[model samples]
Target: MQERNVDIAIIGAGSAGLGAWHAARQHTQSLVLIESGAFGTTCARVGCMPSKLLIAAADVAQQARDAEGFGVKVSGVTVNGPAVMERVKRERDRFVGSVISSMSRIEDEDRILGAAHFEDANTLVVGDHTRIHAKRIVIATGSRPTWPDFLNGAGDRLIINDDIFDWDDLPESVVVFGPGVIGLELGQALHHLGVRVRMFGVGGGIGPLGDPDLRKLADQEFNADFPLDPDANVLRVELEGEQVAVTFHCRDSDTEKTERFDYLLAATGRRPNVDRLELKRTGLALDERSIPRFDRLTMQCRFDDGSLAPIFIAGDANQDLPLLHEASDEGRIAGDNAGRYPDIRAGRRRTPLAVVFSDPQIASAGVSYAELKRRDESLASIAVGEVSFEDQGRASVMRQNRGKLRLYAEHGSGILLGAEMFGPRAEHLGHLLAWAIDQRLTVERLLEMPFYHPVVEEGLRTALRDLNVNLRRGPAITERCLECGPGA
Candidate 1:
């Protein structure tokens, strides 16, 4: 076997591993980046970029169909399924190509192409030919889509979110399992593209929402145009001829119904890719998931007695927050710390932010209301401000008035804590709130920021005005200021 020694060894050259490579190089030159798969990020290859391209087509179709309200008579909105998939694939490859080109710049000597496993805490074996001994190791192997074993009954009829991007054309019908981000986005896109879609989930989760109200609202909003049972009482799933059949007891009617679909897209969830690494050989404290117990602040795994183990896990491997930004930040931190061993320090973790590109788009920033419950803090200690887009001026103007935004603040201190929203422009709204949370802005202070009129952001001011009232930190908004425009 070829034996190599390095200062640091990073597994998985996805976003996290790439970030680690760049950051770690600052403190050490004797490091290697390892990958066993394609040289593009999941976001570029299958996660975000390709999905957004599909959604863009879906959005165009939806807009063309829904243009009647503006006195624009639109007819014959033909959806060329194969053409849609063609653009999706073409643009997706463009994005993946860019990422791969950048990755190609890394010296071949610094890049090892193989599946590696732990030979010891300080040693890794790559396939059959190479053994690597490193002073520090960073696990950034990312994750893969996972589902329950029962889903296997669909056999060849089953697919995952990853398969959607590779399709030559949209299918006739699909039954989506797991109404999280993937399910919602893909399901709605397929529906808008004139494909029959029925989404089911084990739990009553609409997306990545922590607030129950937003979840319910999202469920209602999405179900308006398609079938979605967040908590499905599915009785059976099996292959019937070329299709998959799903038998379920409908929650609304309590009647057993059987539906056949071309495919069952499992949007279930993802598992960290540490199982094949043989983590048992690491000699570190491992959680039930077999992941080494690592400090989030420093990304350092601990030995059984709580000493640093010279190993770190980041990105989807750590599974703290699966967002790409989080993975990148964690990888940078872990890499920097691994490059400068025993000089570990806490990394900067930004205010929590998550977004789902489902219709009306879903977003949450900072501490969620659900998190407050987990903290065992009294609900009364926090104040909530609510704004319904159903009557917001700009939302009404755009004919997108079908969501709600809820902002939270410390009751006594008036500090803006977090926000959850299921509404138009939530992607933008989420960023503003995350920035406010990161700045530790109070409700009063946020209100001092300028808000341009006749924009969707005016709705933010409306919510903040209500929040100021709840915190009682400032005078109530004048009754005249209650409405920004017609029916606002």
Candidate 2:
């Protein structure tokens, strides 16, 4: 067996792991990265980058179909599903290759192309042969698509999110299970591509975790035309000859119904990839949720003796937040604190921002109103604004005017609490709110800042206008003379 020593070891070369490696390399040269698969896991190859590309193409196809409204009488606008899939694969391959090439450029960086398991507190065994010792270790192993046990035997007819990109031809009809981001995005994309799509889930569309208004808008856009059985749960998948049948149990009624489809795509949630790591040897404690019990701030895993190890956890494995950007930032923070001189503890105040990539994207930042209500009964929050994209000039011009922006503010303090946007350019607008929340900006100050007119950003101005209306009627109103105000 071969042995090596490094200042830090990062497992999983995905977004979070890569970000950690970049941050650690700035401090020391003794950085080692290990991945069971090739560099660039689902995000680079299948998850974020590839999936968004297909969504963009599907958007174009939809827009082309709506060209009649623009006084263009265009016909025979056909969607070549095979061609679109080919382009998606080509683009994904290019991006993945570039990431792999860039990772290879780091000096003295050991890249182990095998699975790694903890041998002890500071030791790792990889590929049944090599042993790696490091001062600090990070577990950033990402997640994989999962299916319920009852639907396991569908065999070749069953497709997960990862397998959809590998399809040579699109199926005539698809029944997608799960109502999360993946299911909604893929269902809409396939529907726009002319595939007869039906979605089934237990909760309402997009689940109960997202914004209600945003979920409503998404349902109007995609679920309105497609059959979305929100109160439906899959019971079994039966394969007969060349056909596959799915049996679903309705939550409203006790009736069981069966439907046949050309393909079944399961977008069920993902679990942490800790099964192969054999974590028992290290004796690191875990929480009731089966996740490693670590300090939320410093991300240091504690031992049975109440001593802390240099090992850290981030991304889906840590279970702080499942968003990609949040995981990347957390990984960077963990690496920075792990490599700190004298090992000073770092305080964690993370404001997670996430965007669900759909036709009308859903993006949110900071705490949700429901979560705040649960935590603090007396927490005062004002829904500063919930305006539609139809009022925005840029959205109308782009012909993507089907969304709303809702901002939350602390009633008394006037501090920006959180923002949820579902419309054109929701991702960009959501980041703007995330910046404001992180900086603790006030509604009045945010409005005072200059924003260009006739742009999509004017939607933010409109939302702030709602806050101004509330502040006018609010008890804390402080009116100043227009002549002597800052405007003078």
Candidate 3:
């Protein structure tokens, strides 16, 4: 094996690793980016980008069907699955090409195509080819979908989200497991595209919703489209001919039912790709999942002595926040700190923001609703403001009004702590709220912002005003705010 020395070594050539490579290069020119798989980032390949492509097509089909609500008659709305897959694959390749193109800017010597494992604290070995003694290492190996062994019996009848984009055409029906972000998005998209989709989960949680009210509202709306039992008691899965058969106790029903489908999609969850890295050789302090315990601000893993180790883990490999943007931010932080070494300074950590692309999109920013419930302080310390989009003017006009929003604030400080929403345009709303939280703005300050008439944002203003009233900093909410639509 050829041996080499480098200032920094970044494992995985995905989004986070790429970010780390860029940031680390600013301090040292000697670095290597190693990968065991394709170069494109997850978002560009099997994740957000391709998923959105499918969602966009589904949305168009849904819009056509919903046109009758606006006195527009739409007779036939057929989804051409082959053509849909073609565009998805074509656009997906374009995205992957762009990422590979950016990677081409790096010197060929800095790139290695093989799996890397730690030989010791300061050494890494890649298969039987290269040995690297890296002064500092960044583990951005990312993550992979995880499911129970029982599901493996499905053989070719089982699939993950990654396999969906490669399908030559849509299947007639699919039985999906896990109602998390991945399951919810793909299941709904397939449902709207006229595919038979039945989703079941062990937990009652719907998407990213921690607020029970929003989850319940989401449950009702999603169930109207297809069978979605967020919490179901599943017995077993077995292979029946070419199809997958599932046995489960239906939600709210004591009777057991067996269902067969073309495929059993496991959108269950993801596990960090750290098990095979031989981290024990580094003698680092690992968490329950074998991930190194690291400081969020410093992004530095700790040794057994609780001192900063040379190893840093970021992105999905850390498994803290799995969003693409968060991974990029963490990668930069880890890379910069690794490069700086002994002169390490804390990096800027952005306010938390997560958005689920399901219908009436789900989003959460800053503190989560579940976090507040764990607080021992008085309930009076936290003030909540809520708005229902069911009657919101713009939402009704768009025929897309079917969700709710909640804002949490400090009672005495009047500062907005966080927010959770299951409403129209939540992607945009989540961003505005995240900015407010980052700026440490108060509810009163938010209410002062302009809300144009007949916009979905008027709903945000209504919630902020409600928050102001709860905080007792402003006059009580009027029965009808003439300036904005009446809760409508």
What are the lDDT figures for the candidates, one per model?
0.90, 0.77, 0.90
What does candidate 3's lDDT look like per residue over 1-488, in tens digits? 99999999999988889989999989999999999998889999999999999999999999999999999999989999999889999999998899899998899999999999999978999978999999999999999999988889788898999999998898899999999999999999998888889999877998889888888999998988899998888888999999998998978779999999999999999999999999999999998889999988878899999877888889999998898998999899989987888788888888999998888899999998888877834456789999999888899889878899999999878899999999899999999999999999998777768777789898888888788888856555545566554552
Q: Encode model 1's per-residue lDDT on 142-210: one tens digit a residue.
A: 999999988898999999988999999889999999999988999999999999999999778788787
Residue 366 in model 1: lDDT: 96
Q: Would you estimate the TM-scores of all the predictions?
A: 0.98, 0.89, 0.98
Q: In model 3, how many backbone clashes occur?
A: 3
- What's model 2's TM-score? 0.89
What pairs collide in candidate 1?
A: none
Model 3: residues with Cα > 4 Å off, grouped in runs: 472-480, 483-488
RMSD of each: 1.3, 4.2, 1.4
Q: In model 2, how large is the Cα lDDT of residue 358?
A: 73
Tell how far residue 66 is off in model 1, in angstroms: 0.3
